[model samples]
Target: MRTVKDAWMMVQSEYRGNKLKLVWASLFSIFYMGYIAFFVGIMMNEIVQSNEGHMAVDIMLLSITPLMGFVLNRSAFKYWSEDSYTRMLVYFKSLPIPATVILCKRKIMSVIAFSINGTLCFGLIYAFSKNMRAEMDLGDYIAFTITWIGYGLIVTGLYITFELLFSGKIYLVLTLAVLIVAFGVAFLVQMGGGNLFLYTILCSQEWGLLSPLMWGTLLVGMASVQVFSKWTIHRLKSRDLL
Candidate 1:
């Protein structure tokens, strides 16, 4: 398709100058994530063993563990700095490409990146936890991978929207604020008792991979990417590039 060709061209263009650096960065990210996953696996193994009655909480923790790599690597390094991202946007804008195509490429890239990273990270966790008392089976590992990749897509959509709409400083401030609020709410929920959200997700897993809840979550994530892409296109058309 024309769109696929355009996206491939865009990817090549984006990586034209610094392909080696990007590759190295990606390798480092994988290494760091693997290292962290190993420790987290051990910790989760202990927690699951200790919390015999709270299987829902354990499942919830395991499900979201893949995201920890993203958070950790993001704190330490960036795959694309703001200046580099700005330059890429400017260059792409000057080209004879449609906004939809540009945005579609980004979404597709995000999905691929998260898919690879999430799989490797989760695989490490699963491998490391094999000797533990409360280890998950192969089926649970696969289910968690599918579920969290959906969650990662939703995050990627929001993060791309934020990058488009705000400057570096404001974006960083807002990101920190969002993280603080999320952690605060989650902590409060834990202090009050077990998380209702976790319980709901855990219950949803009863139907295995065919669960409507799981599929619904994936659909929501995909819909979010589409909505965000459209919104970004509109914003770009309506305003001057930063």
Candidate 2:
């Protein structure tokens, strides 16, 4: 469709002169994930071999894998910041294309980035698990990878909404505050011996790949994307981007 073509063109325009940056980003993301995989492999080996309480640690690592996409491939956030700085949103708004198309380009880029990041993170983990003769199988790896990608997409949608709604120093401050709150909550949960929602979802494979929780996670992710996309478009159209 022409709309999809326009969105793709917009994405291309954003990366027009940033091929080198993209390459570096890709390499950095790979190296970062490689380091995590190595670290996780070491921890997994020790945990699997020991009879200590490793379930919490395993849950923490598995929960963190999906979030690594956001931490490493921050290109989407950077691009949004750049667009805001240059008033590119205003320029795009002046165009004949719908606001949905304008935002679609960013979402497409996000999906691509998160998919690659999620695959590398989980693929490397799976490779290490197999080498250690861990209990995981290809099916479990596939389910984890898909679920992580879905969770990444859902987080990206919320992140994009925040970027659109807030800009400049306010956004930076808010982001820092959010990180603090998240870390604080996580620490509390760990101290209290409470399980993370992600832990439940990730371990849902024990009931097989056809688990209702897995399906629900995917459904929630898909629905969240749709809701966030519509909300973003509405906000962009109503905002005075000038």
Q: What is the lDDT of residue 66 in candidate 2?
A: 38
* Tens-digit per-residue lDDT, 9-99, candidate 1: 7766756887775687578768866886787677656655564333333444433432432423232244235444455566777875787
Tens digit of lDDT per residue, candidate 2, span 111-201?
Answer: 6666777777667866776433455566755765566566555555666676666665565676566555556666677677664433543
Q: Cα miss at 151, model 2 (Å)?
A: 2.5
Name the candidate that leads on TM-score: 1
Q: How much lDDT does candidate 1 score? A: 0.61
How large an RMSD does model 1 have? 4.2
lDDT of 2: 0.62
Give the residue spans of candidate 1 off by over 4 A: 13-19, 52-82, 131-134, 195-205
